[model samples]
Target: MTTKTGDQESPLASQVDPQTSVSRVPPPETPAAVQTRFRVIAAFWAVIIFLGFPIWWKTTSIYRASLPLEEMVHWADGKTCRPVFPLEIHLSTPSLPYIEAQHLLRTTQHTLDDLNEFAAHHLRLKLANDTTGDHTGQDSSEHVNYAARETPDTALTVRLLPQEGLASPRSELHAATTQLDVFYPPSQIPVSSSSNSPLSTFIAAELQQLYGEEKATIAHILSGDTARLASTSPQLAEDISRRLRRSMKYAETYHLSFSLFTPGAEPSSWDIEAAVNEYVSPLLQALSPISNFTVDTQVQLYANFAPTAPKPEYDESEAVWTLKKEGLSAFVNAAEWPLNPSIGTGPTINFILYVPDPSQSPLVVKENSASSWIVPQWGGVFLLNPPLSNDEQGSRSNPAHLSLGSLGPAFMTFSHQLLTLLGTPSTPASLPLRLQTSIRIRAATLLLSASSTMGSLARLTESLPSIPIPATVATSVSTTLSHLTATCSHLREGRFGAALASARVAETEAERSFFEKSMVGQVYFPDEHKVAVYLPLLGPIGVPLVVGLLRELKRIAAKRKAKAS
Candidate 1:
C-alpha cells in the first residue's frame, strides 16, 4: 500500500513540476539561419539606401540655376555703363556760303565745348543738307511735314539768316517746332580765315542757355552732385528736385480715371466724353509719343468725406469755403471713396473733381486760395463750384447736370496737373521739347530702376541659400540683362525711343524675376522643418537597420578572430 501511494504521489508531482518548470534554453542558432537573418537586414537596407534615398533626393531637391550676381551688382553701382547725352543740333546757314557755314560750325562747336561744364551732355553741330532757303517764315504745315521725316536723334535745328536792320544778333525759338531762328547782321558772318567769330560765339551762347536746364538735370541724375549744376539757376535745381519728387514712376501705360465726386445728390451727371474730348484729349495725344493712356470717367454722388478729414471752414474775408493747406493731405477719404486702381496693367492715376454742397459752394486752398492741388505720385483734385440754383424748396443746390462748357475750367486745370504728374518740365515752353526731355528722363529712371531690381534679386538669392530659383526666374533675369545692354547701346547712340523701349522691357523682366512666386514661397520653407517632417519615418526604420548592420559586422570580426586563435 505504501509503494502504490508513493508512486501515485510521484506521478502527480512530475506532472505539476513539468507544468511549473522554466523553459529550456533553445539550441544554438544554425549558421544558415544566422546567414539568412543577415541577408534579410542587408536586403532591407539596400532597398532603402540605394532606391528610396535616391528617389527622395531627386524628388525633393531644389533646382537653383546660376546667376550673374557680380555683374548685377556692378550694374546697380553704375560701373557697367555710364550714361551720356550727345545732343545733335543741325545748323542751317541758308544765307552764308557753305565754306563759311562749315567754319561757323567748327567755331561754334569749339565755343560750346569751352562753355559747357557738363561733358556728358554736350551739343554737337552738324551742317543741314537742305539749306536752300530761309525757313524763318516757312509754312507751318511744310515745317511739320519736314520735321516728321527728320532723324529722331536731331534735337534742334538752328537757322542762321541775315537780317538787314539788326545791330545785334537776336534769336527766336519756334513754339511749335524744335527750330531756332537766329537773326544776325550779314557783317557778323565769319570769313574762312577767321578762327573765331562773333556770330559763332553768339550762337554758342544761345544754345548753351537753351540747354542749361537739361544739362543740369541730367548731371543731377547721373552724379547726384549738386555742384555740377552750380552754373544753373537756383530755380532750375528746385524745379528738377520737385519734379522728381512729384513724378510718377515710369510705366508703359497709365490709367486715367476721372471721377466726379460730390457731397450732395445734385450734379449726378456730366458730359464727360465731350469734356475729355474738348480739354484732355489733345494733351494725351501730344503725350502719345512718350506714354500711352486709357481714359475712364464716372460720377459719384453723396460721397461724403471721412470723419477724420478736415472739413472746409467758411472764410469770412474770402466769402468762400477754405481748406487748410496742411490739412489737404487728408482730403481724400481713401477708405470711403471708390478710389480703387483701374483694372488693368500699369499704374492708375485718379483725378477727382469734387463739387461741394451748396452751403460750401466755393472751396479753395487756404494758403494760395487755389481751386486745384496735386497729390504727388498719385493724381490731382479740382474743386468745382458750379453756380447755385434755387430748387423747389427754395434751397440753393448744385446743378443736376454739368454741361461741357461748365466743365472747361476744371478740365483745363486737370490737364495742367496731368503734365505735372507725368514729370513734364516747366521750362522751354515748347510742348515738343518738353516731351523729348521727358523721354530721356524716363529712360534714365527705368534703367536705374531695373538695375536696382537686379541688385536686389542678387542679394536676395545670396542671403537665402535654401530658396529655390525657378527656371522662369533665371530666364527673366537673362531677358532683363540682355534688354538692359540693348538699352545702354541705344542710349549711347542717341536713339531715345529705342532706349526707352528696351528699358521698359528690362524693367518689366526685372520686376517679374524679383517677384517670382515660386522663389518667394520657398523662402519660408527651411531645412529644419523638413527634417522634423521626415524624422518619424526615418527614426524607426533607420535605427533597426543600423543596429543589424553593426551586429553582423561584429559577428564577422569574431569569426575571423576565432579562426586566427
Candidate 2:
C-alpha cells in the first residue's frame, strides 16, 4: 500500500532495497573470515619457523671439533717453539790429564764453532770424567728420551791417538762406532799459548767435509728453496734435485719388498731369505737407527708389459737389447709385477731384480746403456742377465739356479739404490753416520709436511663452513696434534726413529681428517633441485593467503580512521 505523499513509505524499510541488497550480503562475514584467515597464516608461520628453520640450521652447521684452533694457529705461525739442536759432545780423554783434556775440549769447541755455518745445529762439548758416566748417560737418554741434552749425549767421540803420521792430522771414521780417530802429527800439538793453528783448521775442514752433504740436504729441506744452491753451482742444484726426487716420503717403518721378476718362467726360485740375510740384512741393520724395514720376497714369472707399451728394440749402436729411455719408466710392467707392499703401516719400497729371458738378456738403457735406474720414491730395477744356456731345470741355463750367493751383486746394487731411495746420503763413509743423517732429514721433512697439512686443514675448514665435522675428524685432529708434539720432542732428543714413527702417525691422521667424506658433501644442493621442490607448493598456497591478509588490514585501517573522525 502506497501512503500519502511527502515521501512514499514502503511498508518495509525492513524489506531489502535493491541498493541495500547489492551492498549488504551478510556483511560478507568479515570478522569470521578474518579470524579463519589469521589462524591459517599463524599455522603456516609456525610450521616455517619451527620445522623449516630448525631443519636448515641443523643441516647447515659444521660439526667443529673442540680443536685448539688458537694453539694450532700458534704452532703453524712458529710461535709455539723455535727448534734448536743443542747437540751434546762427550769428550772422554782417558790418557790426557783432566786439566789438559778440558783445555783441548775448549779449543776444539772454538774450532767447531768457527767451521759451523748452520746456527741451529751446533756441537756442545762436555768433558766426560768417567767411563761409567758415559754409559749411564747413553742409557738414560735412550730410556727417558729427554729433549734436553745432558752428559754422554755426544754425537761423535774423537779418540786422540799419537800416531807416526809425518805431515798432517788424519781422521779415521769407524764404520760401527760413532768415534773419529783424530791423529795429530806430534809436532802439531797445541802448546798452552796457541790461540790459532793450522791443525785446527785442517780438522775443522775434515769434519765439515764429512757432514757437508747432510748439511746441504737439511738446508735444502728447511729453506724449501733449492735455488739457494745457485750460488754454489747449477750442477750441485741438479744433484740436490735428483736426490730429493729419488728419496722416499718419510715414514716410521719402510716395507722392503724384494721381488724377483723374470720374463720367462725359469729362474723362478731364489734363495731369497739367505740372500736377504747376507746381501740386504746387514745394510738394513745398519739402517735400523733411521728406520725399521720389513722384508718380504716374491718371484713373479710371466710378467709382461701392456700391449700399448713400447716394445724393447735392439740398439745397434749399443749392441744390446735396449728399452727406449722414454719407456724405461714403464719397463717395470707394474700391472704384472707382484711387488705389493708388505702388510704394514709404513710405505713399501720395492727392490725388483728383473731377469730378462735368454733371448732378451743384457737389456740396457737405449740412451746410456745404464744397468740401473731408480723408480723415484718406489724402488730400483737392475736387469740381471745370468750367463745363458738351456741346460738346467727351472733354468734356461746353469746360472738359473742363482744360489743365494748369485744374488750378491744384484742385492748389493739394490741396497745402494734402496739407500738413495730412502734418502740416505752418499757422503760420509760410515754407514751408521749416513743412517743418522737420514734420520735428521726425515724428521725435518715430516715436520714440514705435517705443518703444511695442518695449514691446509685450517684453510679447508674456513672455506667450507657447512660441512659436518664428525667426532672422528676431531679425534683425528687431536691425534695429529699429539703426534706432532711427540715428533718435535723426539727430534730435539735426537731419537730419530721415535720421531719418524710419530710423524708417520701425524701425517696419516692429518690426511684422514682432511678427507673426511661427510665433511666434503655439504654445499652441493643443485639450483635446479630447489626450484623443482618448492615452487609448486609455495606458488599455489601463497596467493590467496596474501590477498586475504591485505584486505583485512585495509578494512581495519579504514574503520579506525572513521571512528577517530
Candidate 3:
C-alpha cells in the first residue's frame, strides 16, 4: 500500500493484515486533545466567574449611603401635605345685647361669603362673652409684639358699637391694634328673621377695606396675582411689588448693610454709628417683632460713575443739575460700588447713600426735578447738594463736605426703600401694625416658597437616576418635613415670628436635600476589556494541569476495563 500523508486518516488508523496482527499506533491523542480543550475553558471560566468578576466588582462599585429616597421624594410631591391658612376674627359687642350681636355676626358672615373672591383664605368670627365686659385680650409675652396673637390669636378684633350721628354706618381702624371699630345706627341692627341687612353691607365694606392689602398680598404671594390686586390701586400694587422685590426674604435675622458712598475720599468716617442709632434705631426696634437685624456701616470712597452713565447736565429750565430718570436705573454703578451685603444668616439689605461731588450739586431728576428716587427693592439715591459754605474768606471748594445732616434725606430714602424691600404694606400707618402684617407676609412667603422648592426637588430626583442618595439627604428631608410641620403649627397659632424661623429651617433643609453631593457618579465600562486582560494569564498556566488530569483518567479507565474482562 502507498503511504498517505499525515492528513490521510487511513495512515493513522490501526490495520490488521491476514498474515500478521499489526499493532498500529492508536489514532494519536484525539481524546486527550478534546479533554485538554474542555479543561482549559473550564479553568478560564472558573477564574472569571469565581475570582476575577468578584474582585472587579469590589473595586469598581461605589459606596452608596443609605437614604430615604422614597420618603424624601414623596414629601417634595404635593401628595404629602397641603398647606392652608385658617384666620380667626374675634367679634366683640360692647353696645348690643347678646342676641342682637349674634344676629349681626351671622348677617355679616353671610355678606362676607358673597363678596369673597378667593376661597382659600376665609375669615371666621368667634363671639366674645358679653356678661364680663372685658373681652379676653392677649397677655404680653417677654416678646413685646404689638400684634402678638394670643387670646385665640384672632386676625382682627371687631368692636360693634351704637353711633347716634352717623346716617348709615362707619368704621374706624386702630393704627396700633388689628382692631376695627364699627359704628352702626341702632335701628339697622338685623332683626331675628332678616337674613340680609344694610348693617351687613356696612360690615362687609369695613372688613373688606381692613383686609384689602392683606388679601392682595396673600393673592400675590400664593398665586402671583398682581392683576387681581385692582382693589388696591395700581399705584399701590406697584408700590407693594416694588417693596416686596426690594425686601429680603423672611429670615430669622436681617443684615443691615449701611454703606456710605462718595465720589472722592474726604469724609471717610461718619458719625455713622451715632446717626444709625439716632435715625434708624427706632425703625429697627419697631421691626423687632418680625425678625432680628444686625447692623454694620461701611464707608467706600472713590466710588466712580459707570462709563455709560450720563454726566450731570445743568438744566436752564429748572436751574438745577439734572439726571435723566431713564438713566437712574444705572446710577448705582454696581460694578465699582462697594455695596457688598453683610455676611450672615439673614439677607443683606444694602443701604447706599451716594454723595455726588459738590460740582454736581443740586442734583434733581431730569424728568421731574425730584430730589430723591428709590431703587426698587435695592436702596435709595438722594442728591445731597449741601449749601455752599464760605471759608473765612468766603470761598467754597468745588465740592462740599457731606454733612451728617445731608445724609438725613438719603437715609430717609434708604429707610423707605428698606421698608418696601421688607414687604411692608403702604396703607397701614402704625409701625407695630405694619410689622405684624410683615410677620404674616413673611410667614406666607416662606411657606409657599418652601413648598415650591419641595416640588422642584421631587422632580429633580425623579428625572435623574444615576445620582446616589446620601444618608444626609434623607436626614435633610426629615428635618425639612418636621420644620414644615412646625412652621404650619406656628402659623395657625399666630406665632408668625416662630413660623418664619421654622420655615427658614425648612427652606435650608430642602435646599440641602436637593443639592446633595456624591449623588451622581458615571457608570460605563466594557466587558470585552475585562476578558482580554484576564485571559492571557489564565491561558498558558491552564493547559498542562488539564492535560495531566485527562491522561491519568484515561489510564485508570483502561486498567479497569482490562480487569473486568
Q: Against the true structure, whose TM-score is highest?
A: 1
Per-residue CA lDDT of model 3 for 1-565, tens digit only, reads 5667767656424464744554555666677787776676667668867998899889865554555556555555545544445567778897778888888888888888788876655667667663343434646453345444443355778888888877888888887777788888888888999998998888887777766777778777767766864466887677667667766656667888887777876446666766687678888888876667888877788887899898889988777888888888888888877776447555777777666676676778888787777665455666656565555867553234455675676676767777777778876654555676677777777776776776776566656544566778767877887888888777666556677778878888887787665663332334556578868976886686567657667876986999999
**lDDT, candidate 2, residue 181?**
81
CA lDDT for candidate 3: 0.71
Any residue pairs clashing in model 1, and if so which?
none
Residue-wise lDDT of candidate 1 within 1-565, one digit each (tens)? 2223633554445546564476766799999999899899889988988999899999999999899999999999889988777888999987777878888899999999989888778888999874454668779998887665444488889998899989889999998889999999999988888888888999999998887777777877777754655688777788888887898887789999999999889899999999999899988998887789998888888999889989889999989899999999999999988887655888999899999989987888999999999999999999989899897999898999999989999899999889989988776867778788888878888888899999999999999999999888889999999999988987887778778889989999999999988888887889889999999968987898899899999999999999999
The Cα error of candidate 2 at residue 97, in Å, is: 1.6
**What's the distance in Å from true for residue 421, model 3?**
1.3
TM-score of each: 0.89, 0.81, 0.75
TM for candidate 3 is 0.75
Candidate 2, 1-565: lDDT as tens digits = 5544557666655466679667755646668777887688767768878998799779745567666666666666666644445456566666677766666777777998977777656667676664433444456647455334332245666676766755878878897777778777666666668765665566666666766677677777777555643233566656776889878877667888888777677786888888888878888788776667887778887777767788878766656898888897777776656667546767988888888777776787778888778899888888877877766465454255678667788888998898888878887777777777776777777776776777777777777665567899889888988988987886676555667678778887888888888877665854467679878978887787678667767877998999999
Candidate 2, superposed: residue stretches over 4 Å from native: 1-24, 28-52, 66-74, 77-82, 128-153, 226-234, 285-292, 304-327, 335-346, 364-369, 390-400, 489-498, 526-565
RMSD of each: 5.8, 5.6, 7.6
As for TM-score, the candidate ahead, 1 or 2, is: 1
Ranking by lDDT: 1, 2, 3
Q: Can you give the lDDT of residue 334 in candidate 3?
A: 81
